[model samples]
Each structure stands twice: as structure tokens, then as C-alpha cells.
Target: MCDVGETTWLDATAQAELVRRGEVSPAELAEQAIARIETVNPKLDAVIRTRFDEARLEAAGDLPDGPFRGVPILLKDLGCTVAGETTAFGIGPLRDVAFPFTSYLAEHFRAAGFVPLGRTNVPELGTTVTTEPKSFPPARNPWNPDHSTGGSSGGSAAAVAAGLVPVAHANDGGGSIRIPASECGLVGLKPTRGRVSQGPLIGEAWAGSTIDGAVTRTVRDAAGILDVIGKPMPGDPYYAPPLPRPLVQEVGADPGRLRIGWLDRPGLEGYLDDPECRAAVAGAARLLESLGHHVEESAPAAMYDQEIIGHFNTIIAADTEATMRAFELLIGRPIGEDEIEPRNVAYRRAGKDLGAVAYLQSRSWLEAWARRMADWWTGHDLLLTPTVGAPPPELGWFTAAGPEEEGVRIISFIPYTAQFNMTGQPAISLPLHWTPGGLPVGVQLVAAYGREDLLVRVASQLEQAAPWSDRHPPIHA
Candidate 1:
């Protein structure tokens, strides 16, 4: 019998290789994953729902010989609905309602032979940047249980970081995937908008500001899973330009000497980067230059436009209102303040009151600015920055004690990541540094739209230059 504890740290690809060699059976893998979740979840609260019995049954049965066959995976609770499973989306009303059909994303995961072990936690409606959902226990960071696992993919990142699974589903709209990956010390890639479908539910999320991907311990696992899940199903509003070749192949491929730009400044005028966070990006830039890449201190002036934050916030609020209204129709009742978080109620109200013309103006403003932002990439293939404006915050830092407090905390922390979401570019967060206190600090790399291949090649190169897979948090399975 394979030692379950020994297998915890292998990337999904390596685990799959073991299964291929018959060194371990899929059932054995599933059992080990379940064991890890049972042991670690009590402390981390990363996985909020479980399908252990179903996972065991699926693993014991004939499964697809897919690249990651029978690997146990957790789906973030907000998106990617699995049939017969309750997709709570971190809201109170939907917790008990099982989706009638599995979403296309979940179906793709199943087709790739990833057994669904459970759904992870998220902030209510994924509206905030920390995972202290009123609907479930907060997803604690494995690095330090007292610090937050960034949201709304916080649970997925925590599970992956804690070794509950090698890789887990995560999506990003306003940096959900990258934020948690930064805090939890994992590789998170938010593929170009439309690189993966959001179908059998909606055409796109947050008006194409969001995309789906995963958080993993290795760059290879991140790239490999993208190859598995990054397909456009029929009826997608638009698809990202297809990759020249498989993303997995891009890993370990020669990226050659490339021009890279670096930004250590926060986009928000009054905001500042912590010394440790600033050093992480500077250090990554120096490393890039050492590796023969041209490095420069530059960023788009458009990114600093004071109005950009308001525009993105308005759009997000509008989308939230639309989602909530749709939910009201489904349940045939209005959601009360007691039924939802207070901050969201305010957002919904603001969105409901937004004039349609003003909403269109915000969208138009973003589109025009995106053109200006693209010009910066002309002489550079990549832009590097601290993944977040600061390191992971202690738990309750973004508490919903009051609406003003929550908004300020969010603005103070996530100033660096929302720009790419508005531009529909591919961005990834790599755990490249750790603070003196032992918390992880991530360095981000952003590439032009439809240029995930470049991001993958360069990220894998960096991964080899500074390996992080061996680094584990104190609270591992």
C-alpha cells in the first residue's frame, strides 16, 4: 500500500504518473485525498462540503484514461456547479438547493477524470477579497491559521497549500485566484478572459473580467490543468485566441531572453506597498535581469487613472445586483438584509440605482483605457509586480463589522490586481519570497491578452530558477 502521507506533496501530474505505472490505484489516490481532507480540514476549514462516498465509487469504477485520471479535486463553491450538489455561492439562500445539472466546467473536470471530492468555501456571493463567509467557517491560511486565505478562491488555495489535494479549481474576477495563491504560497494562473468557458449558466462573468483556472504547488500542474480545462464550449460569447500549442508543452520550453517591465508602486495614490512586498518584486526583477532578460521600471499611466477603481466597482456592483435579482426570481422572494451580508445589500442597492447610461459609460471608459494600457506591452513581453499591495493580512482584517471598514480594507489590500481583470489579460502569481515572519509573498507576472503561452513559458522558467514546490506551510496534511 502506498503511504498516503508520502504522496501529499506530489503535483497532480506526478501523482497521475504513479497511477499510470500502477504504483497506486485511483481508489487508493482518492482515499488518500479524502484522508488528507478529513485530517486537515478541521483546522483549515478549506473544504466546506464533501462528496467522499461518491468520489470513492467513481474512483473504483472505470474512469477515463485522461492525463490526470482519478485525481481528487475540489471545486470552489461559487462557480462551476456540479449536478446534484449544492452550489451555495457562499450565500445563505442557495446552500440547500442542489443544481439540477452539472455545469460545463464541472463536466470538463469530470471528463478529464478529476474526481470531485467536495466544494470549497468563498465569501458571500464572492463579493469580497477574504474568505470569512457567513455561510461557512473561514478558510484559514495554512501558513498561519491566524492570517486570512485570500478570497473568493481562498478555500481552493488553502486546500492546495495544505496538501489536501495537489490541485483544485479556482476562478478569478478581480483577482480571486491570484490573491489566495499569493497568500497561501501556490501557483495561480488566471487565464485570458474566455480562455475557459462559463457556459451552461452564463456567457461570461463580470462582463468578461473573470476567467477560470487553478491553484497548484507547481507551475507544471497549473499549465497542465489549463490544457485540460481551457477550452471554449459552443455559445461562448467569444473565445480567447487559441494557444499555438498545448500550454503544458510551453512549460520547460525555452522562453529565450525577454523584455520585462517591473512595477513596485501601488496604483492607488494614497496606498503603499509593504517593504517586504516591494522587495519581492524588486528581487524578482533583479533575478529576471540576471537570467538575461531586459528589465525596466515602467507601468502604464492609464493604470493610475483615479477613476478606474470606481468604474470597476460600479461594474461589479451592477453584476452583483443582476445576479441577486435573478436569484430572487428563482426563489420567488426578495432577499432581506438578514439573509445576506449587509455590505452586499448596499452594493445591490447601488447597482439597482445605477443609471443604465452611466453603466454603459463605465464599460466604455474601461474599453478605451484598455487600448491605452495595451500600448505599454509593445516593447515588453511581461510586467512584474507584487501580487498584492501587501502581504496576507491577519484574520478579521477585512471584517464586515461595518460597510465603511470593509471597503477601506479591500481598497488598501487589492490595489495591484484588478487592472488586468479590466484589460482581460493573463496574469499569474508565483510564491517567490517569504517575509521574516515566515508568511509567503508572491510576485505577479502579467502578459497581453491571449498571450498565456508566454506567461506559462516564462513562469516555468522562473519556477526552475527559484523552486517553491518543496516549501510547505506549517499546517500540512
Candidate 2:
């Protein structure tokens, strides 16, 4: 077999090319991936379960001639369920809840010939942006073990960053995909709301704030994977506007000159991204300018209002409560307080206290704000910001003594990402800068709703201008 260490660093597309050329068999690829996971997953804690034998079995059997035939990937231990596989959602109460059928995304992955060897770790119910689940040890940043791999896609990000796999499933609901991508120095794309189906189970998540995606080391890998899975499944509540052409075609395509806005602050009072993080965005602005894009200083004024922030959080909390209740009904018993994390218990209480009318009002407010936010894009094609408020934090940095504290800490570290999630727009995080301390700092690029084609074009341009794929973490395979 080819050197597992060297092959592991290749993107999924490159690996698939090798399989197509007969340079390696799918079984060999799976074995290499499994070996790498066994080697590094102990230190990273990125994977929470295993199906190595199943992966080998599939690799040896008849496989579809899909683009990604034989690529081994990990499904984040969130909502991307596989039938009969445990989907804990990173909570104590749901640990034993194996899904009865595969989710739409899982089926798409299988059809694309991806062998899911296991599920990665996640925070409880994906409520937080860090992947510290009470059900298992937190997934560590492969760059630095003591630091966080941003959640709830932390495990997926960690695995990709550490070279355990070239790509893994991740979903964004309030920055779950981008935060970890930024923290782990991988390419993270949060597709426009409804870009990918979340169906056969639920039409929408958090009122359409949640969207499925993947973490990858190369821009083309991100685009290629999106091409495979972004199709609108039957019964989807809605779908994003169709792409004019294949996403892969946009990867190296010229974006032409574009107007871009750079917003260093998240518009919160007394809040600023770390100096390094701010510099990262500034550097990206300079890069875009160098590439002929018109970069200016601007942001949507609607993002600063206190009332809007309150309404946003209200919707999220209400969704959490509703999800818990749904699961309670499924199992025929209410989840006990001791069965959940303390902070989530408090979130449930807050959600329960909000009247249904208030919840609907909150959602209505968000939709109105989304319209206003979209209007801001009239003068700009993209907005640039720091992926997170700060670099990946040291473990325990965001620990809270109470739910109130948890709420405060949540927004403090992750201020820029959720706003786009609320707007159902497309945004991406690219690893363009690294701190002097050697941690990765990502710069975010956001485009109008249903403008992933534009995002992909620009992201591919940036990826070429400042390549980060070869910059492996200290703990990589």
C-alpha cells in the first residue's frame, strides 16, 4: 500500500483519483484511514465511535462509480443519522437512541461512495460552539491539544485537521461548521439555508438556521462534496436557488472584480475580536484588494440592535426545548434534569418559559431582519469578518457556573457567525492566517442568500492566493 501518512494528507478528490487509477484499492484506502484514526484519534478524541470493520466490508464489495467512490469519512455525531447507528446528539438522555432510518444526507453520502467509518463527537444537542459533551471527553484541537476544536462539528473538524480523514460531515446551526473550521484550520462552508435537505425526519432546524455541510482541506473538495449532496430531495420544505452550473466549475473560475465589505467588529458594544483575529480579517481584506476586489469598511447596521439579539437567542432556546420534547415523546418518557447537562437544563427552562406567541414573534422578527440584512448586500457582494471573536480558546476557558453564564460565554466567543445563520445566507471560513503562537485564525467571507456559487468562486481564488492545505497541525497524521 502507498504510505498511509502521505496519502492521508491528500484531499478526498486526490485520493479518489488514486483509486480510479488503480494506484490503490478502496479497501487499501479504508485501511490507511482506519490506521490513521487508530493512531491519532486517541490524542484528539475526534471520533466517538467506530465501524472500521463495516468500512472494510463495504470497500471490498461492489461500490457505485460515484465521484468520491471509496473515500472514508466520519459523520459528525449530530443529526446526520445512519439507520441502526446510535445518534447521541452529544447528550446523556439520547445516547441509546439509534435512528431507525438513515437521514437524507447519510443516503447521499452512501450514494457518493463515501464509507462512514464512525461518528464524531459533538456538544450536547449541538447547543454550544465547542464540542465538550458530558457524554464523552471533548474533541481536542489537533493544532494544540489543550485548545478547543470549535463545536458542534468539532469532531469532524478535528479529524480533518489532524489528517485522520480528508473530509467529514459537519453541519452549521449558529456557526457549528465555521467555528470549528476556523479553529482547526480547515475549509468550512455553511451553505445557504435550504441548500441541502434535512428531511425524512424534519423539514427545518432552529427555524432554518441549521444547514448540513462538510469540512475539507481543499477548496475543490468542499465544492465537489457540495455538488454531490446539495441536491433537493423529495419533500424538502424548500431548496436554495439552483446553482447556474456545477460547483466544481466555479472553484478556479475567475470571480472578476467584486465589491467587498470588511467588518472587524460584530457590532456588539464593548466587544471586539482578538487583535490577531482582527488582523486576520484585515489581512484577508488586503489579499482580496490585491486580487482586484474592491474592499471597504462596512457592515449591516441591523446586526447591532439589542432587541434583535434577544429575539435570535429566543428562537434558538425555543428550538432546543422543542427538540428535547420531541425526543421525550419518542422514548415515551420525559428526560430528567440529571440526564442532561446543567447548562442545557437551564436553556430548556428558559425556552419553556417563553410563550408560544413570543416564540413565533421572535421568528417573525428574525425573518424581517433577514430581509433588511439582505438589502445591505445590494452595495456589496461579500462581507468579510473574523470567523470567531478570538483564536481557539484553551479548554475550560468558556466553562460556566450556570446557564446564564453559559449564554453569555457563548456569544462572547462566537459573535460573528450566528448572524448569518439567522439570515440563512451563505458564509465560509478560510484558514488564511496563523497567530504568532501558531494557532490557526480563519477569516470569514459571506455572500447573499443563495449565493454559494459566488462564495465558492471567491473562496477558490483566496485558497489559491494563500494556500493552507499543506500547513498540517502539529498532531496531524
Candidate 3:
């Protein structure tokens, strides 16, 4: 007989199957996740809320037939709500903005038979790349505690990487999910815009600056969550077209030879990337070649410097301001200027001064980029690049008190990610590298808009050729 407690922390798909077959109870699985949180979160601080009582009651109820029935899940702390639970986004200003009801995403997580374990952390207002926030210390990487797990979905990545759960919910607006997934060795997908709903709370956060997804140890688990949670409400701003009859079939099916456009360095950024980052892309290009895909080195003419940085910052900063302002008003107190981390303060200040004309110009430029990139994609199946130009830095690399240095570091490492956000393309990060010290590195894959099925097919092929889920951390049960 299996020990339910010991097995509860197993891959969520397995746990759900076990629960359905009566080998273990949902309560047992919930207890196992809670135990993991208690044992490891003391050092990691990955989660800010633990929904023990509600999870137990919810688990005890009749469940809908689903692949994830009775499995435990964690939601990131920003923008999602669980009716009576507060979301802090890893900052203190909006710490107690409890909702009287669940958000649509919260309800979707529940309807899929996933028990809510709690809320995880993110960067301050999710503006910065590192997870350290003024509200709490950084969410440390489980593989090596000194390095960061990446953000704005750092806490979810940390919890998943630490084995507190097999997979945890994550959202990306400019590489939040993929960045952390790369740093922590997980599969993260940022579905093309409109693949999932941002409804009932508001239509698409941050002017589609945020995308909700998951970080999972297994490709199948990540795909499974997408099958369940990837729905657009009736009046969504847009919707990814209907998927296949069954997503599981798509994951295991063959992705016939693909035409890949490979860029080892970010063309838009101009400066060459570190050798290791370039090597990772070079190495992945070879892997794609071995997998029988036709790979080549070419791109649309390099973009102007001012266009990439200025427009991305303007649109993203404006979105950040709107989210923070709403949060501040709901909390019934002004956010003390001194309370926030330095970068967020600077962004909010910049956003307030953008004025209508500048903001519109930025939006217009983003549309132009989308048009240019979408046309470029017509001749290729995928684009391959390093997810981030640098490896995961020590925890405080970008969160130090010095703003100018932090700004430069952010610019250097984060350029590749925000481009996908601007393009509204489906992008993913696969754990394809292990550094000298055994830290993970990620390679990025981008597909044209509304082509998540294609992205997953290619990712699944790579994962099958070189599977990674079994690469556990030092703390194995």
C-alpha cells in the first residue's frame, strides 16, 4: 500500500489519478503540500497565504470529472483572488484587499478540481525582474538558495522548483513566467494573447501586459493545465481559436519538420550577449537541426534602439500605473512614496507624466512592430533565442538600492522577453542548460500569434528527446 502523505507531493496528475481511484484522499494530498510549505517555506518564503481550511472543505466536496481532480495548486499573489483571501503581489500596500468573491481564474482553478494551497509572491507590482520586494525578502531559488528564481512569478516558480507542489500558477507580462521557469528549471508557456480569459475582474490586465499560465516540472502537466484553464469568457477582448478535440493528443503527436528562424543574440538589443547565453542558443539550434527541423540564421532588419526600449517601457509603465493606482484606491490609503522599491517608484512617476500623446505613440509603435514581426513569421514555424541574455544573478543583483545600475542590468538581461509581449506571440522557456555550478538556463521558443498548439507540439518533441522532469532538487522525499 502506498503512503498517501508521502505520495501526495507527487506530480499533480498522478496525485489526482490516485485520489480518483481511492488510493489517497484529497485531504492527504493537501496535507502533504502544506507539510512541504511548512518545512521548506521557512527558508524560501515562496508563499504568502495558505488556504488550509477552505482547501480542506473544497476538497471534501463532490468534484467534476477531470484529469486534475483533488490535486493541490498555488496561485501567484497578484491580480487573482479566492474570495476572502488577500493578494499582496509581494508588496505591503495592497496586502489586505480581500475580495468577497473569487475571480474568474480562481473559479476556473477550482472547477478543474485543484485545491488551492495558497498565494505565492511576485516582484513589487510585478514591475521588477527580481523577486525581492520591500514587503518581503526575495523568494529564493530552491536549486541554490543564493540565486533568484526570477519574476514577476518568482514565488510560484520557487515553490514548484522546491517541490512544494508539482506545478503552480504563473502569469507573464514580459517574461515573468518564462524567466523564472528558466532560472528554476521548469516549463513555462506564455500563451498568445486571448488564449486565456482576463475576464470578470477586468479585460486583460496591464493592457494585456499580463498573461496567466503555469510553471510545471513536466511538459504534460503544463499542457494539462492549459487544457483546463485556457478558456476565454463570452465577452473577452479576444480568444485563441478553439483547440483540438483533445489537448493530450496534441502533446504526444508528432510535430512534423518545422522551419526555424534562429537568432543566437538579440538583434534588437544590438550588443552581443554573454558567450554562455549565445552557446545555449547555438546548442539548441543544433538540437532543433537533429530533430529534423530546417534551421537558419536570418531575421527582419534589426530594429532601431529607441523603438524597442522606449515603446515597451511606455506601454508597460502606463499599465503598471493603472494597476497600482487601482490597488492603492482599494486599500483606502495612499501608498507612501517611501514604501515601494525604487524602480517601481520611478516607473509610477514616469507613467504619470507620459501624457496622452506620448502613450498613444508608444501604443502605435507597438502595433507597427506587431505588423512587422507577424509578417516575418509567415515564412517560419518558430523563432529560437536565449530567453534571457544572462544567467540567473545572485538575489540582489537587480534589487540593490542603486537605481542606475539596476536599470542597466534590467536592460541588459531582459530585452529578449518583452519583445514577445509586444508581439503578442506565444513564447515558452525550456530548461536546456545547467551551469558549471548546476544552475539552470533557459532557451526561448516563440510561435506566431494564436499558434499555441504549434509551440506545445515542438516543445513536447524537445522534451521527449531530452526529458527533464526527473531532474529533482537535492531535497527529494
Candidate 4:
């Protein structure tokens, strides 16, 4: 067998190329990824469970001939359930509950020729923005062991950042994908809502604000993976506007001169106005200008209105309650307050008490607010801002206090990502800047609804302009 160590830092696309060239077999790639996880996951606590034996079997057998054939990847613990595998959703009591069927997205991942190595850690119910569930140890940032790897996809981000896997399943509801990507220094693309299916189980998550994608070291992997999994599935409630062509084709395509607006601060009150965060956006703005895109300081007026926080929370509360009830059906028992995190417990209570009229009011308000937010994109091709309001916070910062206080802390850090989720728009987080202390800070570029094609094109251009592929965290494999 070839020495698999050489493939450690290769992106998913390059790894697949090696397999296509007969330089390495599928089993070899799977074994190498398993080894890397064994070596690095202990330090990061990124991976929670393993299906290594199954992966080995799959690798040695006939596999689909797809772009990422034989490349190994991970699934987040929260969603993307695999048949008969543990679907813990990062709660302690549900750790051993096995899903009877696979999710559509999980099937798509396999069809794309990727091997599922294991499952990554996540926040409880994926409710918060940090992955410090009471069920398991926190997924530490590879860049700095004491810092967070933003949540609910934090474990996937950590694994990818540390070279455990080139790409891993990640989903975003309220910045779950982008925030972790920013914290862990990987490329995170949250596709337009309905771009990916969450079917054969549920149609929408977090009132249609959540969507599945992936975190990768390069823009091409992000695009390639999306191409593999972003197809419309049977029973899907809705679908994003069809891409003109495969997303991978958009990579390196000229985006042409486009107008891009940028914001340097968290426009909402009570949210952090972090200097490093602002500087990251400013640096990205300058880089876009240097690449010939017209950049200016502007943002949607609706984004600043604090009313969004309450309306969004209303939806989250109701969803959290509904998710708990669904889990009761799945596990054959109701989850107690002590069995989950306090924040989620609070959400459950609020949701249970929320009247139907109140829930609809919040949803209607946000829907209208989304239209106001989308108006900015009519005159501009992109809206750029810091992916998060600050650098990766030290672990426990968000949960050090009561749940109410934790909610405030989370809002303070993530002011920019959730709104796009509500609007069903596509946004990407690119690791373009690093703090003087060497932590990665990502900047977000958002496009109008169904404009992931535009996002892919410009992201590819930025990838070429400011290459971050060679950078590795100190704790990487």
C-alpha cells in the first residue's frame, strides 16, 4: 500500500484525482482517513463515533463512479442520519438510538462516491452556535485548543481543519455552517434554502432556515460536494431555482465586474462590534476591489432592525418544542429537562406555550422582513461582512451563564449569518484574514436567493486571489 500520509492535506477533489489515476485504492484512502482521525481527533474531540469497519468494507467493494469516488468524509452528529447508525443529535440519553433509515442527503453523499468515516460532535439539538453539548466533550478548535469550533457543525469543521477529512457534512440554520467554518478556518458554503433535501423524515428545519452543505479546504471541494448532494429529491417540499449547470463548472469562471456591498460592524444593538471582525470585512472589501469587483460600504436596512431577533427566536422556540416531541416518538420516551442543555429546555418551554397565532405572526413578519432584506441584492451582486462578530471565542464563553445570558452572548457573536437563512439566500464564508494572534477570521459574501452560481464564481475568483489552501492549524494531522 502507498504511504497515505502524503494525502493528508489534499482536498477532496485532489484525493479523488489520485484514486482516478490508480495511485491509491479506495480502501487505502479510507484507512488513511481512519488513521488520521485516530491520531488527531483525541486532541480536537471532533469525531464522536466511528463506522471504520463499515467504511473498510465499502471501500474494498464496488463503489459508485463519481467525482469524489473513494474520498472519505464525515457526517455531523445532528442530521444526515445513516440507517441503523446512532443518531444521537448530541444529546446524552439519545446516544444509542439508531435511525432505521438513511436521510436523502446521506444517500446522496454515498452516491457521490464518498465514504462515511464516522460522525462528528455537535451542540445539543444543534440549537446554539458552539459545540459544547452536555452529552460529550466539546469539539476544540485545531487552531487553538482552548477556543471553540463554532457549532452545530463545529465537529465537522474541526475535523476538516485538522486534516482528519477533506470535506464533511455540515448544515446551517443560524450560522451553524459558516460560524464554525470561520472559527476553524475552512470554506463553508450555506446553500440556498431547499437547495438540499432533508426528506423521508422532515421537509424543513428551523422554519426553512436550515440547509445542508459542507466545509472544505478549497472552494472547489465546496462546489463539488454541493453538485453531488444539492439535487432535488422526491418528496421535497420545495426546490431552489435550478443551477444553470453543475456548480463545479462555476469554479474559476470569470464573475465579471460586479457590484459588491460590504458592512464592517454588527449593525444591531447589543451585538459585538469587534475590531478584528470589522478588519476582516475591510480586508475582504479591499481584496474584492483589487480583483476588479466594485466594492462599497452598504448593507440592507432590514438587517439592522432588532425585531428580527425576537421573531427568529419565536420560530426557534416553536421548532425546538416540536423537535423534542418528535424525538419522543423516535425514542419511545419523552426527553426530560435534565437530559438536555438548559438553553434548549427553555426553548421547549417557550414553544409549548406559544399559541398558533403567535407562531404564524412571527413567521409572517420574518417572511416580509426577508423581502426587504432581498431588495439590497437587486442592485448588487453581493453583500460582504464578517462571518461572525468576533474571532473564535474561548470555550465555555457562551455557556458560562444561564441560558438567557447565553442567548445574548450568541447574538453578540453571530449577527450576520442567520438573516440570510431566513431569506433562503446562499452565502459563503471564506478564510481570508487571520488575527495577529493567528486565529482564522472569515468574511461572508451573500448572494440573492438561488444565486449560489454567482457565489461559486466569485468565491473561486477570491480563492485564486487570496489562496488559503496551504495554511494549516498547529494541531493538524
- For model 4, how does the per-residue alpha-carbon lDDT over 1-477 read when each residue is reduced to its tens digit? 567668999999999999999999999999999999998899999999999999999999999998899999999998898889997999898899998889999989989899999999999999899999998999999999999999989999999999998999999999999999999999999999999999989899888999999999999999999999998988899999999999999999999999999998876578888899988988889899999989999999998787888899999999989988988998898888988888988899999999999999999999899999989888999999999989999999998877779988988888899999999999999999999999999999999999999999999998998899999999988
Query: TM-score for all predictions?
Result: 0.98, 0.98, 0.95, 0.99
Q: Candidate 1's residue-wise lDDT over 1-477, tens digit each?
A: 589867899899999888889999899999999999998899999999898998999999999888999788999998898777798899989888787777788878888888889999999988788999876788899999999999989999999999999999998998999999999999999999888988888897676898888999999899889998998899999989999999989998988989888889786666656999999998999889888899998888787888888898889889999999887776678888788887798889899899999999999999999999999999789999999988888888888447888887787787678889999999999999999989998999999989989999999988999998889899999
Ranking by TM-score: 4, 1, 2, 3
How large is the C-alpha RMSD of every model relative to the true structure?
Answer: 1.1, 1.2, 1.9, 0.9
Q: For residue 221, what is the lDDT in candidate 2?
A: 93
Candidate 3, residues 30-77: lDDT per residue as tens digits?
777778888888788888878888887877777666678888889999
In candidate 4, list every pair of residues with a backbone clash: none
Work out candidate 4's RMSD over C-alphas.
Answer: 0.9
lDDT of 2: 0.89
Superposed by TM-score, candidate 4 places the C-alpha of residue 379 at a distance from the truth, in angstroms, of 0.7
Native-referenced Cα lDDT, model 1: 0.89
lDDT of 2 at 391: 90
What lDDT does candidate 3 reach at residue 462? 90
Clashing pairs in 2: 129-151
- Per-residue lDDT of candidate 2, residues 165-264 (tens digit): 9999999989999999999999999999898999889899888999999999999999999999998988988889999998999989999999999888
Clashes of each: 0, 1, 0, 0
Q: In candidate 4, which residue ranges exceed 4 Å CA deviation?
A: none
**Pairs in steric clash, model 3:** none
